[model samples]
Target: MISGLGALDALSGPQRFGGATGPLAAAQPSVSASDFSSAVAEAANRTIHTLSQAESVSMTALEGGNVQARDVVDAVMSAEQTLQAAISIRDKIVTAYLEVSRMAI
Candidate 1:
């Protein structure tokens, strides 16, 4: 099984929690995005990149190129997980928007 979600962990590098001990640091984030929109945009971009890479790998394998089965499997699985996580996040955001919309002003 794939160990950790690579895309999320790969985000902006220094933003990742360092070391195997695993608890995130209490220090401020290293991501330079100053607002919610930019942060979400960055994540969306990463999602697209991951999906594109997986698709390319699948295409290469379909053409009987030198691609290995293990590499293709890993790419597809990573793309799948990244997509699933993005969808879940989108659902949560939509749900929150709806809930807030119904609240008393």
Candidate 2:
């Protein structure tokens, strides 16, 4: 049950979060970018792991592998909740960035 904005496991697959490269990596950071990137990558990995687990559970149930309904439901629900929370966090970040960019500096 990962809660809060730190649960950024919504974006799954090969595309990962905070695995910045090229210019992002090349640029100097006022803050410790490595720590932030590592944290984001960790969160993404956790989310991917959870999603894969849920998918496997569902597939097992479909394949009649003696999977329990409760287990499937719990896994699916956890995945869904994680995804929604991550999305919300992403949206907030985007909004905040936009607001900052719009500021008269």
Candidate 3:
């Protein structure tokens, strides 16, 4: 049930990444560069974890380890979607950096 924008939404909130809770989530909307970097790192880690899980499921299924076909399909789909989101975010960040660099200062 993860939407296309779910990853992006998660990055905006500390709760999703298991960081500080309560009042931290209620803090101001401004985000520092360090926070942005941490978010990117977290997103990459999540994508990597999903891809690894998919691979593990596929391998188990291939080895006749009693893994269900539907489980494999679900894992693969989740990994694919997560990877797509990461790539999209990376592209947007690069595009924004390029745009900023080109601006006359």
Candidate 4:
């Protein structure tokens, strides 16, 4: 399971032991914006490929007389899962942006 804020802290900053007086420090550099965008794009491409393959599979199943209804259902389910994953990633990106905007700079 995802660890939420704990995971975020681990990724971005140092741990606080008590009443901290400043921003958390980190041992490594933060992820660059270009890297994040590229990663998002790659995920989107995977989703598109999955959706297209699912559609093709469903169509092929329809054309073949021996095709089972379960095959088409599975294709559709796979497409739905890809779409849900893409949406979830997008939501996380948007939420991060909103959080950054809320921070005092």
**Best-fitting candidate, measured by lDDT?**
3
lDDT of 3 by residue, 1-105 (tens): 343344445554564444556765555445566766766776677788888999999999999999999999999998888888778888999999999999999
Assess candidate 2 and give its TM-score to the true structure.
0.69
TM-score of 1: 0.70
Candidate of highest TM-score: 3
Those runs of model 4 whose alpha carbons end farther than 4 Å from true positions after fitting are: 1-27, 64-66
Tens-digit lDDT track for model 2 on 6-103?
Answer: 53343332233344445554353333556556666777677778788999999999999999999999999988987776777668779998999999
What lDDT score goes with residue 69 in model 1? 98
Clashes of each: 0, 0, 0, 0
Kindly indicate the candidate among 1 and 4 with the higher lDDT.
1
For candidate 4, give the lDDT: 0.62
Give Cα distance to truth, residue 21, candidate 3, Å: 19
Q: List clashing residue pairs in candidate 4.
A: none
Clash pairs, model 3 backbone: none
* Preferred candidate (TM-score higher): 1 or 4: 1
TM-score of each: 0.70, 0.69, 0.75, 0.63
Q: Which residue segments of model 2 deviate by more than 4 Å?
A: 1-31
